[model samples]
Target: MSEPMSRRTLLGATAGTAVAAATGFVPAPATAAGNRVPAVVRELDAKIEEAMAAYMVPGVAYGLRYRGRDYVRGFGVTSLDDPQPVDADTVFRVASTTKPFTGTAVMRLVERGRLDLDRTVRSYLPGFRTADPAASARVTVRQALNHSAGWLGDYFLDTGNDDGALARYVDEMSRVPQLNPPGKYFAYNNAAISVAGRLIEVVTGVTYERAVRELLTGPLGLRHSAFSLEELPGVRWAVPHVPNEAQTEIVPQPAAWAMPRAINPAGGLISSARDQLRWARFHLGDGRVPGSDRRLLSRRSMHLMQSNPGPGGTLFVELDGVGVTWLLRPTAEGPKVVQHGGDWAGQHSGFLMVPARDFALTVLTNSDTGPTLLDDLFVGDWALSRFAGVHNLPAVPRALPAGELAAYQGVYTGEQIYFDGSTLTTQFEVVPDAGQLSVRIDGTEVARLAFYRRDYVVFPNPDGTVGNQRANFVRDRDGEVTWFRLGGRLYRRGAEATVQRRSSAPATLPRPILS
Candidate 1:
């Protein structure tokens, strides 16, 4: 819960937009908090409201489920051209949160032993490739979800300007050398997730999109859910936004980025608060997604899907943390939390679960920059402290072992960098002049690169570290820290680094990125 602000005050903050918080994963069942919100939650609510105003979100949809009963609320209009009040019935894209459903779909076959995690990508998808034999041989479905497939984030590389171009970009990446070995270090790849979805289709004899709804959402009884614009619910959806350098929101024109048909599994699933609440209830252990005892699968499989599959370091976690998608960040209350957020056009949405407290929150916004505005609400010391209530966590995780992080200190380029080492990458962009600072990384760039945090002075540090950052290096017997840190992943430096590193240190390090 967060501090409360007057609805009038919030309205004036944006042209009219607001943010809501996304709690942690593994939520417990939520019940009424008596009549009043504890002082802590009230304070958090206010902070969230402030964050929304800062981001210029026009509308927000939020829900809190505690004990058994739940509370769902909405603010502002659902649409801009045709303004309508958003409510529990309004739908928003689940985005990457769709990974959990995708994961479940794959596991359905896994439980039946019809599919294997160790199988290579070509085993199922056959010709899936980018003309790079090395990448084609090494990439696998496990690597897709793990973000270890060596594919860099596509947001920077190509705009997918057209269907032909999007296909070429996917193929072009196939030819690029992988950043790390499959299942080694985590480097998120939305394309990889989509490919994984294709794997489900190959094995199940059903389209990946339909299989997920039929296997997971359908059993859960989620009525208002779909993957495409044509099959979607009514116009009760939030608009997505893009913020300017000043954090002022702007409506982005529909482009290759706005459409869904390209990468549906990676980040595309429109759903409602009422429906998502039930989805959150599953993780909260209410079990039986309001239907049969199919168990859908097993708790073991679900937990495995949720666990962190990183390269045993904080750096890897930064690339792709716990949970199949989004993140399973820990709370001050020691709660194993799971969360995900989305932004498309004027729509912004986020969802979270606090299992220990038996509570969960889902928020959707109608703003180009709403997801980011909504995300900032869940961050910061005071903001996080208030939402988790008292400090229940055993202790906070240090930035990571300096020595280990040093090994991870190269440039990392991938399909996307959601929040690489606190360095903002995807979904949040600060365009400078005619162009934005968006980067495209090959397999190697994922390590050396760091997102430049804006400062009046020392802007865009030529070095990988943002700000005057410090690093530590861990080496193997070869006294080589590269293999041990970057997990033996080879990142080819572009013209910029090709010259820079020559004047600094030797290009090659003996240790590879993985164990």
Candidate 2:
């Protein structure tokens, strides 16, 4: 961890005056009418600076559109080596934050009668399929957008970067095993979303990049956003950083591993704080092009994109369900806070909006620790409380009764599916420790588990903070624990001692079932 710096030191070193700007490319209303920064803006600035100093993030750029005003600012240097200060124009890989853009593009097509959300993948991308033939035909475009397609979502293969990349990606999906029946469960599936991007390409008869630009970014007048790094030249950009082996310092990662171009639709866009704010305002403002009366999408379609489809269970403590691509969390005050976050390699970015308040916040950072800071310092601490009126407190682990822990001790096995449709018989061993339970996969400790609800166990976040991902243990008619669901896929208990004894390292860590 980096030594914490005082706000005074941060202001003295890198603070800049906030600038007032138009909300979007179109001309409607000025985000800030006066030169003086608002109190909320000052508070957010201080919090960000404090977070940057404590987290050792090389740079951060953020913008907020609140109550008809826009505040955008940047702090610290772009890179420790370069020392070029970050500004509103500085671009960072938005990663999966790009999904909302693709979602908006699809909604636009839906409004124009060019596409149908209920249409199956086979109807559009005939080449798209899953290991289950029935599942492929049953999956619909809406399910793909909402991550309910039930296939493995973390498929991150690098098909060559080109116009045909999405097509090849869809073809590759033929090998991926379906995790759940279509629309039966919610799993954060990047491969499913990539298929949605391919659907956009097929329905519009244009490349996915071209479709996103023409339908969304181009209309919103997003100048510094692109599906690939090659689209933004001569523009300053932040490089991803990861902690060194000692875990006390940070270092830049190789550019090649930053983000794969083949997953462009799922999480490939490079954007700046300035451009992201405009994108946010577009969603908050009912699909109308900012600065003009022209409607990019019908208000009805815009609402559809933000509306929660069903009770898909929670991700974070407050997150309620999935919308088109937006994650919906209802506030205590009767309004919904719709948001999405993206992380690729070490770059972390968050886009959050409270439509009820006509407000939105965007944060972009260049460190693996950025997401933790974004949650701990910004979203979880300040943004949700101050703007959304929800005071999110850290969850305390409740001690389990002495005998209750014994019931969970056992070796469980399930079919683990890879991004490329490969499968492995995975084993999870739960052993009771002093009152707590330790979850082990193969020989490595995965997490310290605690009961969050009667049958649900929550693990800690990557930083050992309260985690949003959880496992719900299930029982059979005999009342014996038979299976468990984590990351939205079911893992059955080993059928016999032989299955339980055979264990191997997981190809990847289990992810949160929801995004």
Best-fitting candidate, scored by TM-score: 2
- The lDDT of each candidate is 0.49, 0.69
Per-residue lDDT for 202 in model 1?
A: 67
What is candidate 1's lDDT per residue for 276-295, written digit by digit as tens?
77788776663355445657
Q: Which candidate comes out best when scored by lDDT? A: 2
What candidate 2 gets wrong by more than 4 Å, as runs, is 1-33, 254-258, 378-381, 392-397, 402-428, 432-436, 441-446, 456-515
Taking all chains together, each candidate's TM-score versus the true structure is: 0.67, 0.82
Q: Say what the RMSD of model 1 is.
A: 10.7
